[model samples]
Target: MASVHPRVPESGIMSRPRPRHLAPVALLIVSALTLVGCGSDDESSEPPVASATEAEQETPGPDDEPTEPEDDTSLADFLRSAKVDDALVNRLGEVGDANGYGLGEGVETSLEERQQLATVQVGTCRDVAVGHRTWEGIQASDVSSGGTEEQAAAMADFLREEFCPHVAPYKEAPLPKQSLGGPEEDAKGGRGLASPVSWWDTRYRRVSWSEECAAQTGQPIGDPVAYRLSDDAVVCATVPPAEQLKKHLISVDVVFAEPVGEERAQDAALSLLPIDAVAEDETEGTNPDWSYLEGGCLNLNIQSQDLEDVVAGLKENAEPWAHAVHYSDGATADGAVGPYTGEVKQVSLSTGRNEPTDSGDLTC
Candidate 1:
């Protein structure tokens, strides 16, 4: 679905990505055999979704001859080269059960198999013909249905768990220690971005992404940093690292469409900072009503190497960001990612918060 949430972080707090992608999470309160569902009632309009079930009856397979043009011309060569024989499908089951996720015998299959199985299994299901299309730069899953999202998530999770050590494309032997956090948070402690602030620090966090995400992002694929794809929508921070605070780098998630290259993406990322525009308010007493925005991470090590430029980019971008209204907080900002977009939103621009260090370095 086309997201009403801006593809990129709009300038301000109120303008962050909306959390529309997240499935409604209801807290099931179970007491003495009585189950009371407790959560925001706003999601009451959503349909009672069903999970993807194993194919009860397989439909006659598609013709060997091509029916329509390949769904994704980009994937033609890969599909042709990659074997999807009965052996591979069976392997999926073996891997699934071995991993203990209970994918069982038929739940695990390739994108092609999922489409074919859907034809007969779910009457209303539409085949996600082989193709590649990213939503806001994330790889969109080939399967899209009530339980498809859950299935895709589970598959990605188990595949990474079992195969990442040897098969993951992004795993490097001497992988750099990394931490996710904001500019303010130190590598030692304090909450800044998320974690893994260092490239090769021992305290870094281990990250993983799904094969669907790897295929869709079309980046340095087969890596842990690959942007995670979603069947329905996306959440920030949960996928790849957006803009890294270490060496400054941006991803399509932040800049929107094709960034062209590192230079262009860097420039665009810097634009979002709005440092110059907010100079007058940069003083200690300055307190512009600030909020947060978010972007996606490409997981690429490429960078501009100019840390100042990166901070400036954050400052510049936040100035004009379209702010979203916070019904609970009674606050607003330039823009936001979505309701479930997660953290890594906009960094604080308040004078004290964005103040420079003794060496004149940006704090966050």
Candidate 2:
């Protein structure tokens, strides 16, 4: 019974990704919800503060750039308020009105909670011109516990009837495994969900250069939804059970392509971590994950839960060009020596004689 509110700093609140997969307790009300930095529900909360390419561009001369559009307060308000009705007609209307899109007549919206599903759809013409952006894309969840059969069936129905019909014509109904969020646990039979993780709290880039090559070459980048569906998405890896760590070092060997010096490697590893999680500093209440990168070899100690998950994600998302990566979390080994067979013979160097020993042969 709590609403997701942005956790802001004292100075101001900056838009960040919505924690759609947030655990219930994480949805508890914070101090106040502000419209100043809030973004639409579909938008990632972390709006990019600055762009590298933009910085490199020389300041636009007075004649080079047109007058920038003025801030639309009402439109901003609508984006900030981010509300949905039972039918979701208002939501659809608001989006269409804001973006000048159309929802064909006779669209039905029956299922209420199905809006949270993660999906990819063809965006506006502008989106296509730049790159195919995720239209009305929701955050995909990793914490879902697969809802009841009834809930699953209803979601399937919604996908077949509403989503596939109107949103994505080429997309098929998402299997239960693909459902982003899941059923609420009853006290009698369910375990409580874990605290929310802020992995998805990332800056959203409006324009994409992914399809730049295709656009330049006059080639199709294929269906946007299909492309996204087939794309190799790296998700958080499942942690092994405690028993799996019987006699293994909970470590990982990461080899960078070019040998980045220890200092640079350490810094790069540190940058991948969240602000709250500690690395070098061992202050009070500090949960640190150690990494020592030498000669392009990053020997990591994946002790903390956050660090373990992060390493798992790295393994999952590793590019083909990366040097090498090996995990030892759930690794096992055998102690017995090699099985060998050999004939036993005694050779006397002084006499230059070879004689068969009492031991006929040896086998191990």
Candidate 3:
């Protein structure tokens, strides 16, 4: 046999050994190609496992919907979050252990009505904050009552910040001063400023004749006849049909002025009455001068149509005096001696003077 070389495969001569580093890389490429070729076309197939970092970094797909956030900004929610007292919360229309605050149509008040209540509450708080009115005065107001001083302050801040931002201006703007009496004072006296004098009228409501007429009587009576009962009281009567010429007493109010003490006010009111006027009734053990009028003041229920003529005559006689006379309808009759434009010192239905009684005496 001719020299036989080790049988070498014909392919072995053309192929060279891959480097060790490249061998692993070549194996990976081949494995990937094998996976791609063997993979199913269906999208339902399991996806490839992601690395820890890649998994977290994955974005939401088309069908991945986001959830809506819960609403935590409502008034009720705000009250709860603020940790307000249950009693105070009840006043704000929030459901609480206490009764409703009598705002709007009870607890189920409309949005508009609630807003109105908030406005009023905020305004009152502003008054208290500005020192124009006290927290004690809140109870005296017909609109805003029943809230405590602390509650009033808190609710004012809450409403201004969360509820009624439009009323924020009231925080800076000071309101006109009101003659508000404290609860203790109101309890001692009837209303308004507490006074010792019997003739001092404190129960007077600041209402116009028309407003009083509409309030007292169901219907709105036009151009009702008014009479000056005394400096403090004006009796507004409804003018019925011609057949019923007798006017009905609808409302009684005081000709308001700066409050003086009870004794001086009583004396002033007593001095304003017509000299010829007779006592409607008498209370025993009272001063004889005060006995002329009932309740230490003129009768508010006086139903005399002739009182207009009497008032006119008294006004004519008073023209020569130095002071100005304040009438019920807010008209002032100037006297000859002085055009006295000061606040009416006093007014009472029980008192009047046809002639000047005493120039130094203050007019009720």
Candidate 4:
């Protein structure tokens, strides 16, 4: 400039030349000082912009993980989060759904009307998790017909992980076999019928009664014979002896408040005895009164091949008989036959009068 640089315009200014390396250093220093000055001047100023790596480390990305679910989340909320069908969820919240879930009576009354819906939905899930109810059963039910297998499984898993952790082990556990009055304990001695009369005497006074005798013992007989023991009792017997004898072998004594007719006596006998032993024709043309017998006794023929099995069945069914006659009817009879004594033989029943003395005033 001092040596007379060519006529430069006034708008254009000329500056002294500097090293390129120093230029970059000076620029960085100026930026740092500007940031410092800004921070010092205003305590509330914005912070410095973060670098690419710093921003990534400090800020969450779209793929950031979610936190754990809260314990108090409602069943509908959970099911929706699990992607369960909305139709199924709404149906589950309907009234009387608790009973459908196997939550027996009083649920509606015990819980608030608002709470019942959630309770039922949660109960269904818990039952499925604990092996009390099946996922298939739930699917077949009206409430969950629209839900798929995956949705059902998810509900069970939700119950295990959230509501009831104790049910988790049962989720894989084998369901217990249904009981069908399984085989009873073996009869101790040779099987023969014994009366509950002896046991009844200890509890109530023994009533005495006379009986009319009848027999058809030689050949295989076609029909059972009825002997009236009292106004409320009748003894029906299979005429043919189980073995060679002059008396009936299988006898069923029925006692009730009403007078027992021949038809009633035959029906009662068939009910107590095994079906295989009775002829097909024997059941024909008979309108069996299926009403419960008040008090009764059975004399099992000692010669029977399945005496032990028959006795076991009788013992297993004793509770219902006791309930019907003794407890409900307020009778003094034990209502069930006594334990087998192994002493009653063909000769013991020779008189053909097999009345049971268990019922106090209603002996038969």
Which regions of candidate 4 deviate over 4 angstroms? 1-107, 111-136, 142-364
Quote model 1's TM-score.
0.22
lDDT of 3 at 169: 27
Best-fitting candidate, scored by lDDT: 3
What's the candidate order when arranged by decreasing lDDT? 3, 4, 1, 2
Taking the tens digit of each residue's C-alpha lDDT, what string does model 4 give over 140-242? 3322333335544544444445444321111111212232322221122111122221221222222222221121111001223333333554443332211
Off by over 4 Å in 3: 1-99, 102-108, 115-119, 122-132, 136-263, 267-364
lDDT of 4 at 6: 11
Give the winner by TM-score: 1 or 3: 3
**Candidate 2 per-residue C-alpha lDDT over 1-364 given as tens digits, one digit per residue, 9 for 90 to 100:** 1111101111121112222221221112111122222332235445566677786685677688676987534322322233322244344333322222222112332221112211111112123234322122111110122233343343334333443334322222231123223322211111111111111112111112233222211111121111110122111111111222211112111223233343443333333332223332210111011101111111222112343332332223311111111111100010001111111010000000111125421110
Clashes of each: 67, 5, 14, 1
2 versus 3: better TM-score goes to: 3
> How would you order the candidates by TM-score, starting with the best?
3, 1, 2, 4
State the lDDT at 184 in candidate 3. 23
**CA lDDT of 13 in candidate 3?**
12
Judged by whole-model lDDT over C-alpha atoms, candidate 1 comes out at 0.25
Q: Which stretches of candidate 2 lie over 4 Å from their true place?
A: 1-146, 164-267, 271-364
